[model samples]
Target: MTGGAVRPEGPRASERAARPDGALMIEARSISYAYKETVALRDVSFGLPKGETLAVVGPSGCGKTTLLSLIAGLMPSTAGQLRVDGAPVQPRRPGTALILQDYGLLPWKTVRENVALGLRIRGMKPDAADQALREVGIADLAGRWPHQLSGGQKQRVAIARSLALGPDLLLMDEPFSALDALTREEMQDLLLSIWRRHRTSLVLVTHSITEAVYLGQQIMVLSPRPGQVVGLFRNPTVGDRRAAAFHEMVNRVRDALEKGVNGGA
Candidate 1:
Protein backbone atom coordinates (compact mmCIF):
# COMPACT_ATOMS: atom_id res chain seq x y z
CA MET A 1 0.00 0.00 0.00
CA THR A 2 2.92 2.34 -0.56
CA GLY A 3 1.91 4.95 -3.19
CA GLY A 4 0.52 2.97 -6.08
CA ALA A 5 -2.56 4.58 -7.67
CA VAL A 6 -5.10 2.41 -9.49
CA ARG A 7 -5.95 3.60 -13.01
CA PRO A 8 -9.34 3.08 -14.62
CA GLU A 9 -9.54 1.27 -17.93
CA GLY A 10 -9.96 3.61 -20.91
CA PRO A 11 -11.88 3.73 -24.23
CA ARG A 12 -11.12 0.16 -25.22
CA ALA A 13 -12.61 -1.04 -21.95
CA SER A 14 -15.72 1.04 -22.54
CA GLU A 15 -16.01 -0.38 -26.07
CA ARG A 16 -15.93 -3.94 -24.78
CA ALA A 17 -18.58 -3.10 -22.19
CA ALA A 18 -20.92 -1.94 -24.96
CA ARG A 19 -20.94 -5.31 -26.75
CA PRO A 20 -24.13 -7.31 -26.82
CA ASP A 21 -24.80 -10.35 -24.64
CA GLY A 22 -24.86 -13.98 -25.93
CA ALA A 23 -22.31 -15.40 -28.29
CA LEU A 24 -21.79 -13.39 -31.45
CA MET A 25 -23.85 -14.82 -34.32
CA ILE A 26 -20.82 -14.40 -36.53
CA GLU A 27 -17.23 -13.34 -35.89
CA ALA A 28 -14.19 -12.67 -38.04
CA ARG A 29 -11.06 -12.08 -36.04
CA SER A 30 -7.73 -11.10 -37.57
CA ILE A 31 -9.08 -12.57 -40.83
CA SER A 32 -6.54 -12.37 -43.57
CA TYR A 33 -6.31 -13.93 -47.01
CA ALA A 34 -4.13 -13.70 -50.13
CA TYR A 35 -4.21 -14.75 -53.74
CA LYS A 36 -0.60 -15.73 -54.16
CA GLU A 37 1.24 -12.60 -52.91
CA THR A 38 -1.67 -10.16 -53.22
CA VAL A 39 -3.28 -9.61 -49.85
CA ALA A 40 -7.09 -9.62 -49.63
CA LEU A 41 -7.84 -8.98 -45.99
CA ARG A 42 -5.53 -7.80 -43.24
CA ASP A 43 -6.44 -8.16 -39.61
CA VAL A 44 -10.10 -7.48 -40.34
CA SER A 45 -12.27 -8.13 -37.34
CA PHE A 46 -16.02 -7.66 -36.68
CA GLY A 47 -18.98 -9.35 -35.03
CA LEU A 48 -22.71 -9.56 -35.64
CA PRO A 49 -25.14 -9.61 -32.75
CA LYS A 50 -28.19 -11.82 -32.87
CA GLY A 51 -31.03 -10.31 -34.95
CA GLU A 52 -28.81 -7.43 -36.16
CA THR A 53 -28.02 -6.58 -39.73
CA LEU A 54 -24.37 -5.66 -40.25
CA ALA A 55 -23.47 -4.16 -43.63
CA VAL A 56 -19.98 -4.19 -45.04
CA VAL A 57 -19.07 -1.51 -47.62
CA GLY A 58 -15.88 -0.67 -49.45
CA PRO A 59 -14.34 0.07 -52.83
CA SER A 60 -13.73 -2.61 -55.47
CA GLY A 61 -11.24 -5.34 -54.66
CA CYS A 62 -11.41 -4.26 -51.04
CA GLY A 63 -12.09 -7.84 -49.88
CA LYS A 64 -15.78 -7.32 -49.19
CA THR A 65 -16.73 -10.27 -51.38
CA THR A 66 -13.81 -12.25 -50.08
CA LEU A 67 -15.07 -11.73 -46.56
CA LEU A 68 -18.50 -13.00 -47.56
CA SER A 69 -16.98 -16.04 -49.22
CA LEU A 70 -15.03 -16.78 -46.10
CA ILE A 71 -18.11 -16.43 -43.91
CA ALA A 72 -20.13 -18.68 -46.18
CA GLY A 73 -17.34 -21.25 -45.89
CA LEU A 74 -16.99 -21.32 -49.67
CA MET A 75 -13.28 -20.83 -49.11
CA PRO A 76 -10.98 -20.96 -46.13
CA SER A 77 -9.06 -17.90 -45.00
CA THR A 78 -5.33 -17.95 -45.49
CA ALA A 79 -5.04 -16.81 -41.88
CA GLY A 80 -7.11 -15.97 -38.81
CA GLN A 81 -10.32 -17.50 -37.51
CA LEU A 82 -14.06 -17.38 -38.25
CA ARG A 83 -16.88 -18.48 -36.03
CA VAL A 84 -20.61 -18.77 -36.51
CA ASP A 85 -22.55 -18.71 -33.28
CA GLY A 86 -19.62 -19.74 -31.02
CA ALA A 87 -18.62 -22.67 -33.25
CA PRO A 88 -15.87 -22.62 -35.86
CA VAL A 89 -17.40 -22.36 -39.33
CA GLN A 90 -16.96 -25.38 -41.55
CA PRO A 91 -16.94 -25.75 -45.33
CA ARG A 92 -20.69 -25.87 -45.02
CA ARG A 93 -23.09 -25.40 -42.13
CA PRO A 94 -26.81 -25.87 -42.02
CA GLY A 95 -27.19 -22.80 -39.79
CA THR A 96 -25.98 -20.32 -42.42
CA ALA A 97 -27.00 -19.45 -45.98
CA LEU A 98 -25.94 -17.15 -48.82
CA ILE A 99 -27.87 -15.17 -51.42
CA LEU A 100 -25.93 -13.89 -54.38
CA GLN A 101 -26.75 -11.05 -56.78
CA ASP A 102 -27.59 -13.48 -59.57
CA TYR A 103 -30.33 -15.18 -57.53
CA GLY A 104 -28.69 -18.59 -58.20
CA LEU A 105 -32.00 -20.27 -58.83
CA LEU A 106 -32.01 -23.50 -60.71
CA PRO A 107 -33.50 -22.83 -64.14
CA TRP A 108 -35.19 -26.19 -64.43
CA LYS A 109 -36.98 -26.07 -61.11
CA THR A 110 -40.36 -24.44 -60.67
CA VAL A 111 -40.63 -21.52 -58.30
CA ARG A 112 -42.08 -23.64 -55.50
CA GLU A 113 -39.56 -26.37 -56.06
CA ASN A 114 -36.68 -23.91 -56.09
CA VAL A 115 -37.84 -22.27 -52.90
CA ALA A 116 -38.35 -25.69 -51.36
CA LEU A 117 -34.91 -27.02 -52.27
CA GLY A 118 -33.40 -26.35 -48.87
CA LEU A 119 -36.37 -27.75 -47.04
CA ARG A 120 -36.41 -30.69 -49.35
CA ILE A 121 -32.81 -31.39 -48.53
CA ARG A 122 -33.72 -31.29 -44.86
CA GLY A 123 -36.63 -33.73 -45.46
CA MET A 124 -39.41 -31.24 -44.83
CA LYS A 125 -42.89 -32.30 -45.96
CA PRO A 126 -44.02 -31.17 -49.40
CA ASP A 127 -46.83 -29.10 -47.89
CA ALA A 128 -44.38 -27.36 -45.60
CA ALA A 129 -42.27 -26.50 -48.62
CA ASP A 130 -45.33 -25.01 -50.26
CA GLN A 131 -45.93 -22.97 -47.14
CA ALA A 132 -42.47 -21.48 -47.43
CA LEU A 133 -43.23 -20.32 -50.95
CA ARG A 134 -46.35 -18.60 -49.66
CA GLU A 135 -44.39 -16.91 -46.91
CA VAL A 136 -42.23 -15.18 -49.50
CA GLY A 137 -45.29 -14.01 -51.50
CA ILE A 138 -44.44 -16.27 -54.41
CA ALA A 139 -47.06 -18.96 -53.92
CA ASP A 140 -49.00 -17.87 -56.97
CA LEU A 141 -45.89 -18.26 -59.03
CA ALA A 142 -45.06 -21.68 -57.67
CA GLY A 143 -45.58 -23.38 -61.00
CA ARG A 144 -43.50 -20.90 -62.95
CA TRP A 145 -39.94 -21.59 -63.90
CA PRO A 146 -37.04 -19.22 -63.26
CA HIS A 147 -36.92 -18.00 -66.87
CA GLN A 148 -40.59 -17.07 -66.71
CA LEU A 149 -40.13 -14.67 -63.80
CA SER A 150 -38.91 -11.08 -63.65
CA GLY A 151 -35.57 -10.21 -62.08
CA GLY A 152 -37.18 -9.09 -58.83
CA GLN A 153 -39.41 -12.17 -58.74
CA LYS A 154 -36.42 -14.43 -59.22
CA GLN A 155 -34.56 -12.71 -56.41
CA ARG A 156 -37.58 -13.12 -54.18
CA VAL A 157 -37.63 -16.82 -54.91
CA ALA A 158 -34.00 -17.06 -53.99
CA ILE A 159 -34.69 -15.24 -50.76
CA ALA A 160 -37.69 -17.43 -50.10
CA ARG A 161 -35.57 -20.51 -50.50
CA SER A 162 -33.06 -19.21 -48.00
CA LEU A 163 -35.76 -18.27 -45.49
CA ALA A 164 -37.51 -21.62 -45.81
CA LEU A 165 -34.49 -23.27 -44.32
CA GLY A 166 -34.70 -21.02 -41.25
CA PRO A 167 -30.99 -20.47 -41.05
CA ASP A 168 -29.57 -18.56 -38.09
CA LEU A 169 -27.51 -16.27 -40.29
CA LEU A 170 -28.00 -14.97 -43.85
CA LEU A 171 -25.13 -13.77 -45.99
CA MET A 172 -26.05 -11.65 -48.98
CA ASP A 173 -23.51 -10.39 -51.51
CA GLU A 174 -24.90 -7.38 -53.40
CA PRO A 175 -28.21 -9.24 -53.81
CA PHE A 176 -30.00 -6.13 -55.00
CA SER A 177 -27.10 -4.38 -56.69
CA ALA A 178 -28.23 -5.20 -60.19
CA LEU A 179 -31.83 -4.09 -59.81
CA ASP A 180 -33.20 -0.72 -60.92
CA ALA A 181 -33.57 1.93 -58.22
CA LEU A 182 -37.24 1.24 -57.58
CA THR A 183 -36.77 -2.52 -57.57
CA ARG A 184 -33.80 -2.17 -55.30
CA GLU A 185 -35.85 -0.21 -52.78
CA GLU A 186 -38.65 -2.74 -53.01
CA MET A 187 -36.29 -5.64 -52.46
CA GLN A 188 -34.72 -3.85 -49.49
CA ASP A 189 -38.12 -3.36 -47.92
CA LEU A 190 -39.08 -6.97 -48.58
CA LEU A 191 -35.85 -8.19 -47.03
CA LEU A 192 -36.37 -6.11 -43.91
CA SER A 193 -39.93 -7.33 -43.57
CA ILE A 194 -38.84 -10.95 -43.83
CA TRP A 195 -36.02 -10.38 -41.36
CA ARG A 196 -38.41 -8.76 -38.92
CA ARG A 197 -40.64 -11.79 -39.06
CA HIS A 198 -37.85 -14.36 -38.89
CA ARG A 199 -35.42 -12.47 -36.66
CA THR A 200 -32.43 -13.89 -38.50
CA SER A 201 -29.07 -12.14 -38.35
CA LEU A 202 -27.90 -10.75 -41.69
CA VAL A 203 -24.52 -9.74 -43.07
CA LEU A 204 -24.77 -7.90 -46.39
CA VAL A 205 -21.81 -6.80 -48.47
CA THR A 206 -22.45 -3.92 -50.83
CA HIS A 207 -20.89 -0.98 -52.64
CA SER A 208 -23.83 1.39 -52.10
CA ILE A 209 -23.71 3.59 -49.05
CA THR A 210 -27.45 4.33 -49.20
CA GLU A 211 -28.26 0.63 -49.34
CA ALA A 212 -26.05 0.00 -46.33
CA VAL A 213 -27.64 2.84 -44.36
CA TYR A 214 -31.14 1.70 -45.27
CA LEU A 215 -30.61 -1.91 -44.22
CA GLY A 216 -27.97 -2.04 -41.52
CA GLN A 217 -28.23 -1.24 -37.82
CA GLN A 218 -24.47 -0.85 -38.01
CA ILE A 219 -22.28 -0.25 -41.01
CA MET A 220 -18.61 -1.15 -41.28
CA VAL A 221 -16.49 0.66 -43.85
CA LEU A 222 -13.41 -1.13 -45.10
CA SER A 223 -10.24 0.21 -46.63
CA PRO A 224 -9.00 -0.72 -50.12
CA ARG A 225 -7.23 -4.01 -50.83
CA PRO A 226 -6.14 -5.94 -47.77
CA GLY A 227 -9.35 -4.56 -46.36
CA GLN A 228 -9.60 -3.44 -42.77
CA VAL A 229 -12.37 -1.68 -40.88
CA VAL A 230 -11.70 1.97 -41.53
CA GLY A 231 -14.87 3.29 -39.90
CA LEU A 232 -17.93 2.17 -37.97
CA PHE A 233 -21.30 3.96 -37.67
CA ARG A 234 -24.35 2.98 -35.71
CA ASN A 235 -27.81 4.22 -36.60
CA PRO A 236 -29.89 4.45 -33.47
CA THR A 237 -32.97 5.56 -35.40
CA VAL A 238 -34.20 2.17 -36.49
CA GLY A 239 -36.93 1.99 -39.20
CA ASP A 240 -38.93 5.07 -40.28
CA ARG A 241 -36.85 5.26 -43.42
CA ARG A 242 -38.72 8.39 -44.48
CA ALA A 243 -37.81 10.24 -41.32
CA ALA A 244 -35.33 13.14 -41.53
CA ALA A 245 -33.19 11.41 -38.89
CA PHE A 246 -32.78 8.41 -41.14
CA HIS A 247 -31.72 10.64 -44.02
CA GLU A 248 -29.20 12.37 -41.79
CA MET A 249 -27.63 9.04 -40.84
CA VAL A 250 -27.50 8.07 -44.48
CA ASN A 251 -25.69 11.27 -45.35
CA ARG A 252 -23.28 10.71 -42.52
CA VAL A 253 -22.37 7.28 -43.82
CA ARG A 254 -22.11 8.57 -47.38
CA ASP A 255 -19.77 11.35 -46.32
CA ALA A 256 -17.64 8.96 -44.30
CA LEU A 257 -17.37 6.62 -47.30
CA GLU A 258 -16.40 9.51 -49.58
CA LYS A 259 -13.75 10.64 -47.13
CA GLY A 260 -12.43 7.10 -46.81
CA VAL A 261 -12.10 6.81 -50.57
CA ASN A 262 -10.40 10.19 -50.98
CA GLY A 263 -8.14 10.06 -47.95
CA GLY A 264 -7.54 6.31 -48.08
CA ALA A 265 -8.58 6.14 -44.45
Candidate 2:
Protein backbone atom coordinates (compact mmCIF):
# COMPACT_ATOMS: atom_id res chain seq x y z
CA MET A 1 0.00 0.00 0.00
CA THR A 2 2.41 2.66 -1.21
CA GLY A 3 0.37 5.80 -0.76
CA GLY A 4 0.15 9.27 0.77
CA ALA A 5 0.06 8.39 4.47
CA VAL A 6 1.86 10.94 6.59
CA ARG A 7 4.39 10.13 9.42
CA PRO A 8 6.96 9.83 6.60
CA GLU A 9 8.14 6.50 5.24
CA GLY A 10 10.88 3.95 6.09
CA PRO A 11 11.79 3.62 9.81
CA ARG A 12 8.91 5.86 10.99
CA ALA A 13 6.30 3.19 11.63
CA SER A 14 8.87 1.36 13.75
CA GLU A 15 9.77 4.54 15.58
CA ARG A 16 6.08 5.15 16.15
CA ALA A 17 5.59 1.59 17.34
CA ALA A 18 8.73 1.77 19.47
CA ARG A 19 7.43 5.01 21.04
CA PRO A 20 6.52 3.09 24.19
CA ASP A 21 9.94 4.11 25.53
CA GLY A 22 8.59 4.79 29.05
CA ALA A 23 6.22 7.53 27.91
CA LEU A 24 2.48 7.30 27.95
CA MET A 25 0.49 7.83 24.79
CA ILE A 26 -2.47 9.28 26.75
CA GLU A 27 -2.65 10.71 30.27
CA ALA A 28 -5.68 12.04 32.14
CA ARG A 29 -5.43 13.48 35.61
CA SER A 30 -8.39 14.52 37.72
CA ILE A 31 -10.42 14.99 34.55
CA SER A 32 -13.92 16.25 35.22
CA TYR A 33 -16.83 17.64 33.21
CA ALA A 34 -20.16 19.41 33.73
CA TYR A 35 -22.82 21.12 31.68
CA LYS A 36 -23.53 24.14 33.82
CA GLU A 37 -25.29 22.25 36.67
CA THR A 38 -25.42 18.71 35.31
CA VAL A 39 -22.17 16.98 36.10
CA ALA A 40 -21.11 14.27 33.66
CA LEU A 41 -17.61 13.04 34.53
CA ARG A 42 -15.61 13.50 37.71
CA ASP A 43 -12.01 12.97 38.65
CA VAL A 44 -11.31 10.33 36.05
CA SER A 45 -7.60 9.58 35.77
CA PHE A 46 -5.94 7.01 33.52
CA GLY A 47 -2.87 6.36 31.43
CA LEU A 48 -2.62 4.51 28.12
CA PRO A 49 0.76 3.32 26.96
CA LYS A 50 1.64 3.76 23.31
CA GLY A 51 0.41 1.01 20.96
CA GLU A 52 -1.88 -0.55 23.55
CA THR A 53 -5.69 -0.71 23.36
CA LEU A 54 -8.10 0.39 26.07
CA ALA A 55 -11.80 -0.34 26.26
CA VAL A 56 -14.07 1.80 28.43
CA VAL A 57 -17.30 0.16 29.54
CA GLY A 58 -20.11 1.45 31.72
CA PRO A 59 -23.84 1.94 31.82
CA SER A 60 -25.44 4.43 29.45
CA GLY A 61 -24.96 8.07 30.46
CA CYS A 62 -21.79 7.25 32.39
CA GLY A 63 -19.86 9.80 30.30
CA LYS A 64 -18.02 7.02 28.50
CA THR A 65 -18.45 8.75 25.15
CA THR A 66 -17.73 12.13 26.69
CA LEU A 67 -14.37 10.80 27.86
CA LEU A 68 -13.48 9.95 24.27
CA SER A 69 -14.33 13.50 23.19
CA LEU A 70 -12.07 14.85 25.86
CA ILE A 71 -9.24 12.62 24.69
CA ALA A 72 -9.85 13.56 21.07
CA GLY A 73 -9.76 17.22 22.13
CA LEU A 74 -13.26 17.85 20.80
CA MET A 75 -14.00 19.75 24.03
CA PRO A 76 -11.99 20.84 26.99
CA SER A 77 -12.37 19.10 30.28
CA THR A 78 -14.19 20.99 33.00
CA ALA A 79 -11.15 20.57 35.27
CA GLY A 80 -7.77 18.81 35.49
CA GLN A 81 -4.97 18.00 33.12
CA LEU A 82 -5.31 15.95 29.93
CA ARG A 83 -2.46 15.25 27.57
CA VAL A 84 -1.75 13.14 24.52
CA ASP A 85 1.69 12.39 23.10
CA GLY A 86 3.15 14.55 25.90
CA ALA A 87 1.31 17.70 24.77
CA PRO A 88 -1.87 19.41 25.94
CA VAL A 89 -4.85 18.13 24.01
CA GLN A 90 -5.80 20.04 20.90
CA PRO A 91 -8.92 19.79 18.80
CA ARG A 92 -8.62 17.26 16.00
CA ARG A 93 -4.92 16.77 16.64
CA PRO A 94 -2.94 15.36 13.78
CA GLY A 95 -2.73 11.55 13.80
CA THR A 96 -5.74 11.39 16.13
CA ALA A 97 -9.08 10.15 14.71
CA LEU A 98 -12.49 9.67 16.25
CA ILE A 99 -14.97 7.18 14.86
CA LEU A 100 -18.55 8.04 15.82
CA GLN A 101 -21.29 5.52 16.53
CA ASP A 102 -23.53 6.78 13.74
CA TYR A 103 -21.01 6.07 10.95
CA GLY A 104 -20.79 9.88 10.31
CA LEU A 105 -20.88 9.50 6.54
CA LEU A 106 -22.28 12.07 4.14
CA PRO A 107 -25.34 10.52 2.57
CA TRP A 108 -24.41 11.90 -0.84
CA LYS A 109 -20.89 10.53 -0.95
CA THR A 110 -19.89 7.23 -2.47
CA VAL A 111 -17.80 4.83 -0.39
CA ARG A 112 -14.67 5.91 -2.24
CA GLU A 113 -15.42 9.58 -1.71
CA ASN A 114 -16.18 9.08 1.96
CA VAL A 115 -12.93 7.22 2.50
CA ALA A 116 -10.99 9.94 0.72
CA LEU A 117 -12.58 12.82 2.62
CA GLY A 118 -10.23 12.97 5.62
CA LEU A 119 -7.14 12.35 3.52
CA ARG A 120 -8.00 15.30 1.29
CA ILE A 121 -8.50 17.48 4.36
CA ARG A 122 -5.03 16.45 5.60
CA GLY A 123 -3.54 17.40 2.18
CA MET A 124 -2.81 13.74 1.41
CA LYS A 125 -3.31 12.17 -2.00
CA PRO A 126 -7.00 11.29 -2.07
CA ASP A 127 -6.13 8.65 -4.64
CA ALA A 128 -4.69 6.64 -1.74
CA ALA A 129 -8.27 6.04 -0.60
CA ASP A 130 -8.42 2.88 -2.66
CA GLN A 131 -5.58 1.36 -0.64
CA ALA A 132 -7.46 1.99 2.60
CA LEU A 133 -10.65 0.53 1.17
CA ARG A 134 -8.69 -2.56 0.24
CA GLU A 135 -7.21 -2.75 3.73
CA VAL A 136 -10.68 -3.02 5.21
CA GLY A 137 -11.67 -5.39 2.40
CA ILE A 138 -14.09 -2.92 0.87
CA ALA A 139 -12.26 -1.79 -2.25
CA ASP A 140 -14.92 -3.50 -4.33
CA LEU A 141 -17.61 -1.43 -2.65
CA ALA A 142 -15.89 1.89 -3.27
CA GLY A 143 -18.27 3.02 -6.01
CA ARG A 144 -21.45 2.17 -4.07
CA TRP A 145 -23.44 4.86 -2.27
CA PRO A 146 -23.81 4.68 1.52
CA HIS A 147 -27.48 3.77 1.42
CA GLN A 148 -26.79 0.87 -0.86
CA LEU A 149 -24.54 -0.85 1.67
CA SER A 150 -25.52 -2.99 4.62
CA GLY A 151 -24.89 -1.84 8.20
CA GLY A 152 -21.62 -3.79 8.39
CA GLN A 153 -20.49 -2.46 5.01
CA LYS A 154 -21.19 1.10 6.11
CA GLN A 155 -19.08 0.53 9.20
CA ARG A 156 -16.27 -0.80 7.02
CA VAL A 157 -16.28 2.41 5.00
CA ALA A 158 -16.09 4.37 8.22
CA ILE A 159 -13.10 2.30 9.40
CA ALA A 160 -11.47 2.67 6.01
CA ARG A 161 -11.79 6.43 6.23
CA SER A 162 -9.96 6.57 9.54
CA LEU A 163 -7.37 4.03 8.42
CA ALA A 164 -6.88 6.08 5.27
CA LEU A 165 -5.79 8.98 7.44
CA GLY A 166 -3.28 6.69 9.18
CA PRO A 167 -4.29 7.71 12.68
CA ASP A 168 -1.86 7.09 15.53
CA LEU A 169 -4.48 7.42 18.22
CA LEU A 170 -7.82 5.82 17.34
CA LEU A 171 -10.89 6.55 19.42
CA MET A 172 -14.00 4.57 18.61
CA ASP A 173 -17.40 5.15 20.25
CA GLU A 174 -19.37 1.94 19.86
CA PRO A 175 -18.31 1.52 16.25
CA PHE A 176 -19.88 -1.93 15.99
CA SER A 177 -23.05 -1.47 18.04
CA ALA A 178 -25.17 -1.14 14.92
CA LEU A 179 -24.16 -4.45 13.42
CA ASP A 180 -25.66 -7.90 13.83
CA ALA A 181 -23.79 -10.50 15.90
CA LEU A 182 -21.90 -12.27 13.12
CA THR A 183 -20.92 -9.09 11.35
CA ARG A 184 -19.85 -7.50 14.59
CA GLU A 185 -17.55 -10.44 15.25
CA GLU A 186 -16.15 -10.16 11.75
CA MET A 187 -15.46 -6.48 12.19
CA GLN A 188 -13.89 -7.09 15.57
CA ASP A 189 -11.48 -9.61 14.05
CA LEU A 190 -10.62 -7.18 11.28
CA LEU A 191 -9.90 -4.46 13.85
CA LEU A 192 -7.61 -6.80 15.82
CA SER A 193 -5.67 -7.56 12.68
CA ILE A 194 -5.28 -3.88 11.90
CA TRP A 195 -4.13 -3.09 15.42
CA ARG A 196 -1.59 -5.88 15.34
CA ARG A 197 -0.08 -4.44 12.20
CA HIS A 198 -0.29 -0.71 12.92
CA ARG A 199 0.18 -0.63 16.71
CA THR A 200 -1.85 2.55 17.16
CA SER A 201 -3.04 3.67 20.57
CA LEU A 202 -6.73 2.72 20.69
CA VAL A 203 -9.52 3.74 23.03
CA LEU A 204 -12.94 2.20 22.55
CA VAL A 205 -16.11 2.95 24.51
CA THR A 206 -18.70 0.24 24.43
CA HIS A 207 -21.59 -1.22 26.46
CA SER A 208 -20.75 -4.84 25.77
CA ILE A 209 -18.69 -6.63 28.38
CA THR A 210 -17.59 -9.38 26.01
CA GLU A 211 -16.40 -6.90 23.45
CA ALA A 212 -14.45 -5.02 26.09
CA VAL A 213 -12.63 -8.14 27.20
CA TYR A 214 -11.94 -9.21 23.67
CA LEU A 215 -10.15 -6.05 22.55
CA GLY A 216 -8.88 -4.06 25.49
CA GLN A 217 -5.48 -4.89 26.89
CA GLN A 218 -6.60 -2.39 29.51
CA ILE A 219 -10.26 -2.18 30.47
CA MET A 220 -11.63 0.82 32.33
CA VAL A 221 -15.04 0.93 34.00
CA LEU A 222 -16.76 4.22 34.82
CA SER A 223 -19.60 4.81 37.21
CA PRO A 224 -22.98 6.29 36.35
CA ARG A 225 -23.64 9.98 35.64
CA PRO A 226 -20.96 12.11 37.24
CA GLY A 227 -18.75 9.31 36.07
CA GLN A 228 -15.82 8.09 38.12
CA VAL A 229 -13.26 5.42 37.49
CA VAL A 230 -14.55 2.43 39.37
CA GLY A 231 -12.37 -0.31 37.93
CA LEU A 232 -9.45 -0.96 35.65
CA PHE A 233 -8.45 -4.44 34.50
CA ARG A 234 -5.43 -5.70 32.63
CA ASN A 235 -6.08 -8.45 30.12
CA PRO A 236 -2.79 -9.81 28.82
CA THR A 237 -4.60 -12.30 26.64
CA VAL A 238 -6.59 -9.80 24.63
CA GLY A 239 -7.65 -11.00 21.14
CA ASP A 240 -7.79 -14.58 22.31
CA ARG A 241 -11.45 -15.00 23.08
CA ARG A 242 -11.13 -18.77 23.19
CA ALA A 243 -8.61 -18.63 25.98
CA ALA A 244 -9.67 -20.46 29.11
CA ALA A 245 -9.71 -17.39 31.30
CA PHE A 246 -11.41 -15.02 28.84
CA HIS A 247 -14.85 -15.55 30.34
CA GLU A 248 -13.36 -15.09 33.78
CA MET A 249 -12.19 -11.61 32.85
CA VAL A 250 -15.62 -10.80 31.47
CA ASN A 251 -17.21 -11.86 34.75
CA ARG A 252 -14.85 -9.63 36.69
CA VAL A 253 -15.75 -6.68 34.48
CA ARG A 254 -19.44 -7.49 34.85
CA ASP A 255 -19.14 -7.49 38.60
CA ALA A 256 -17.32 -4.18 38.54
CA LEU A 257 -20.00 -2.67 36.30
CA GLU A 258 -22.74 -3.75 38.70
CA LYS A 259 -20.78 -2.23 41.54
CA GLY A 260 -20.63 1.04 39.65
CA VAL A 261 -24.37 1.07 39.12
CA ASN A 262 -25.26 0.11 42.66
CA GLY A 263 -22.77 2.39 44.40
CA GLY A 264 -23.01 5.21 41.90
CA ALA A 265 -26.77 5.41 42.18
lDDT of candidates 1 onward, in order: 0.78, 0.86
lDDT of 2 by residue, 1-265 (tens): 1111012111234434554555678888888999899999999888887787889999999899999999999899999999998899999798899999999999999999999999888888997789889998989998999999999999989999999888899999999998999999999999988987888889999999999998887888988998998888777557778877788989999988998899935
Q: Judge candidate 2 at residue 204 and give its lDDT.
A: 95
Candidate 1 on 1-265: residue-level lDDT in tens? Answer: 0011111111233333544454578777788999999999888777677767788888999999999899988988888888888888887798899998899999999998888787878788656657667777878999999999988898899888888787889999999988889998998989877876676888899988778877787778887787877777765544456778778978877776676677754
Give the range of the ten consecutive residues with the poorest summed lDDT in model 1: 1-10
